[model samples]
Target: MHAAAATAFDATPIGSREAWGWRGRTLSRPVATASGEGWLRLVSAPADKACGKLWEGPQEAERLMPPAVPRPRLRKRLTWTEDEHGYLAELYDEVTAPTVTTHEPILREAPDLNDAWWEGLSTALDAIATVSSDRVAVRQEYLDRAMPQYLGIPIDTTVPAWTTAHGDLHWANLTSPSLSVLDWEGWGVAPAGYDAALLYSYSLLVPDTAAEIRRQLGHILDTPAGRFAELVVITELLQTTTRGDNLGLERALRARLAYLTEG
Candidate 1:
């Protein structure tokens, strides 16, 4: 993949520094492009699973998202085949600011997020929700089944409102000092307040940060749609805990579920 990225982008990958996604499905490295410095990301999938929303999300986001949203800009894309595997290489404008975390979605420590950063996030989220997309990030069927099975809430599973969302808004996908959101491969339609709810859920490990998020997004998080979105996120994380993912957040998540249900 490194060789392919270098050849396709006509750039030299630097050093041993590399970023990898879950199960090594994606790899990102800094490169020296002819225009300037850039980040190269490579995604791989079985040939059968290579054509779908996930495969085309970045390009779609590049086309649809406005400049007001602070995100990495996709520069170019290339695709290739090797055996049963399909590989995609995407080069993006370099973002110098580091991610809020080295890895992991849960925030263990508080980041010095300023008012501007918080305001930018709120504004960007508002902008994102207004866009229309057929891609479904959190399906109603999954919410219907997961909420009852995980949250023990047998109430109507229909989402109160549906809106376009970043779909996977977490600490690792965010940057500080300048506030650039990353990883647009999953942006799509979801329950209203889904992004805020997801960010609030991940911030739970740090109470102050979580409280700040709640405060910044109170207009959304405090509404019925927002509450339902929170429950949906909680349900998903609880289900993942059974798979040994995010075990540290299990207790906090359950407590949150109890609070939400009790309220």
Candidate 2:
């Protein structure tokens, strides 16, 4: 998103201070959203397939997403300005409550999730799965091509199914208390288990939480396609770690891969 990963919470990207903060504290992370107001995102160009997906992601999500899902509505698409890396910075409005807690390092233990929260999240995902759009993207080829290089090993490139997904389904993008799936910039068609796998990978630091996600999404993740999608997600996080993201998750991710391959 930013010129470098270091620019996440601190950079106050040019032209985006109003959305993020003019005077914020120290931080790291490319995306930033004010609690009750708006958010700014780091993007590249329409030509860059990955950045292009990020740019169109929220708009498409706004159009196709079900009513119950919690997401920041796109109030407007601000003009893109060139960033330090020749990427672009865009801003939009936040829809959900400011009090909601995104599951980063905040949650010391699992929150007691009621049936409604689970149902809403699951139903929202189901609605996304039914959508059909090539404009809203994240193709299967990206995973297939990146896997060998990312994992430092070969893989079975057979993709059995594809569906709409919140491509970056991680702790930071998710909120507890009400189960809101934030950050639609990565929403698009992907291998079936991609979303579940991403959340699973992110939850690896907590065994009980990770087990709960697996149990809840077992129907989707138990299939061959889901397992492969989980592999793709693991490879991605592992790659991110290589660049200094989740340093603690590498060992857990490798263990997961071994378990998956064995199963």
- Among the numbered candidates, top lDDT falls to 1
| Model 1 lDDT at residue 131 | 89
RMSD in angstroms between candidate 2 and the native structure over all alpha carbons: 6.9
lDDT of each: 0.92, 0.63
Off by over 4 Å in 1: none
What's the C-alpha lDDT at position 54 in model 1? Answer: 90
Candidate 2, 166-252: lDDT as tens digits: 777766566656666766766777888778778777777778877887788888788888888888887777887878777788888
Off by over 4 Å in 2: 1-51, 80-108
Candidate 2 backbone collisions, by pair: 8-29, 8-30, 9-28, 9-29
**TM-scores for the candidates:** 0.98, 0.73
Candidate 1: residue 137 Cα off by (Å): 0.6
Q: What TM-score does model 1 achieve against the real structure? A: 0.98
Per residue, candidate 1 scores C-alpha lDDT tens digits across 1-263 of 76777787898887888999977899999999889999999999998898789999999999999777899999999988889998889999999999998779999999998999999999999999998889889998898778889987677888999999999999999999999999999999999999999999998989999999999999989999999999999999999999999999999999998898885
